[model samples]
Target: MEPTILQGYELAKQLYAKHGIDVDQALRQLEKIKISVHCWQGDDVKGFLFRDQELTGGISVTGNYPGAARTPQELRMDLEEAFRLIPGKHKVNLHAIYADTQEKPDLDELEPRHFEPWVAWAREQGLGLDFNPTCFSHEKSKDGFTLSHPDPDIRKFWIEHCKASRRISAYFGEQLGQTCVTNVWVPDGYKDVPVDRMSPRIRLKESLDEVFAEPLNPAHHLDAVESKLFGIGSEAYVVGSHEFYMGYGLQNNKLICLDAGHFHPTETISNKLSSLALFAEGLLLHVSRPMRWDSDHVVVMDDELLDIGRELVRGGLLEKTHIGLDFFDASINRVAAWVIGTRNTLKALLRAFLEPVDELKKAELDGDYTARLALTEEFKAYPFGAVWDYYCASQGVPVRETWLEQVRTYEREVLSKREQAAAPAQL
Candidate 1:
């Protein structure tokens, strides 16, 4: 590593050691935490299965930025570039629609063979893989209903899709020797006020039961349910509301995906972690930034992000919680978005790990609220940045903003070429 980084880290270590914190131990823990990078961000949520299909499910990726990946190869290449810049080994989150196969198959007909390429790539990268069932952007879900559709046929289609997704998820785990979380998030609700919400929820419950009928080994496969408060058309009632999924997840002993953008504007998922950690079997966190709504903006080093890191570390919930990024911002350079968001997440976690938690807890227990508050605020100005810089250098990733130059070089060469080749012929 650089001499400056070493010098800074030594100073940071001494400062942290004074507070009964072990910088080396913190770095070791940070090295093991892998953040699952979302794949859809590279291509603005457009997958290989139906590239022309308009994004449904109240999900929207804004901006027409140049160099969006056009094929599975291009997407993987872009992801490789992203991973090269980001430190540590991290998993990639793939949706069902990202299936790569010679023979086209419908959602319900999806099989593990279709995702063999992803597993192979993950293996080559020494990384893990996570999956999601794409229950939106399809003809069957055109009417804004999926698992809870009143029509039994439509409901069966979604159920079969979810089941197929589980098998594929298990396949990923079996191939890579890591647990794959298969999250189910359906866009089933009404545009306006609905009188009969109970029936749809009942149907949804039955559909989920059928989807999870065939038990899969937890070591290879894990099931998770994600809930959203409201969406574009479903502004009034969202079938899989927080309350609905929380209860379902607890009763069914499944992971509950808490999306930062899926809740009300004021509510934060950080506070919910403690309660869910106690009751839920596990948790899948969709770290994101919501601008006024479920806009899915790129994550930044903000207060909420820090709080989330603090909660996860302080509550000792990292082992049971699957950390994943969920925002897709097409407005900026897509690859940079991945690096920025993933790096910021790591920084937050590192900051949390470096915290003098025992001291803070003791102060709180001893009714020394002033000391607790003072220490909490005081540590905010500590030399965590030096520690972060050292960590980045140790991981062989570009330190500070130096990574952006590589991204710019990539954009100037590879991304710009793609944009040019994709542009229509000049008159």
Candidate 2:
């Protein structure tokens, strides 16, 4: 560790100690929390199985960024680079479309063998793995209806895909010795106001029931359902709205995935955690930054992110909540996006862990809102950055913006070469 980092950490430690906060204990807690890094960021959500397919189902990755991973191997290489820069061991979140196999298989026909390479890689990296069924961006879903499609055949196909995904998720957990969460998200809705919204929701409920009919070991695998407010095509209404999934999740004992960008711009997911934590089996958070819509922009150290971390710590919900990132910014260097988002998430959690929670609770309970407000505002100026820098150095990652230079070097050597090699041959 740098002398400056040690000196700063010592000062920060003493300052925090004055407030009854144990800096070392906070670091230990931070070390144990892992953020599941989404794999789609490396390749702009364009998985290997169907490279020629257009990203449908209201999903779009803007920007013709250079060096987008063209193959599974390249994506893995980029992820390895990202993992090296990020602190601590974490899980990789995979969608079904990212299947790596010689034989081509449709989504419904996908099996555990299709994702063997991912498991093998995760094992080698000593990391955990999470999964999601790719219910969108397919021929059947081109009409913007899946799961709740009126066509029985189409609904059956998606249901089978979800079932297969659960098995694959279980395989990951069994191999990695960590429970894998298979999140289900579908873009089933109408672009215009529909007269019969009830039928689609009813069909969706039945389909989800059929999908979860098979009982899997809770220790090895868990199921989660994600809801969206609206999408590009489904502008008027989304079939899997929050109310639908929240009720279903509570009744069926499934994890409800609360995506930060999936709700109305005014609504924040931080406030929903406590209420959901009370009834839901578990929660899966898809942390992302949305600019007026579900843009899937890379996450930054913003207010909502901090509030999310604080809620997890203040409510003691870390053990039950699975933290996974969900964003893909094709406009920038993909690997750097991962490092930046993951690091910021850790920083937010660290700040929350270093808070004098007991004191704050006491102030609130004693009807001293003034002190509660005063202390929180005052603590914002504390030397939290020093503790973060020390943690990064101790975890073998670059401290602060120093990691950016390494990313630039990687772009110059590896990513730029990929772009050159992929360029059309000039006559």
- Candidate 2 lDDT at 241 equals 98
Per-residue CA lDDT of model 1 for 1-427, tens digit only, reads 9899999999999999999999999999999998999999999998888878889989887898888888777888899999888878989999999988877799999999998888888899898999999999999999999999999999999999999999999999999999999999999999999999899999999999999999999999999999999989899999999999999999999999999999888989999999999999999999999778778889999999999999999999998999999999888999999999999999999999989999999999999999999999999999999999998898888999999999999999888788777633211
In order, what lDDT does every prediction score? 0.93, 0.93
Candidate 1 lands at a TM-score of 0.98
Off by over 4 Å in 2: 423-427
lDDT of 2 at 53: 89
Error of 2 at 156 (Å): 0.7
Cα misplacement distance, residue 318 of candidate 2 (Å): 0.6
TM-score of each: 0.98, 0.98
Off by over 4 Å in 1: 423-427
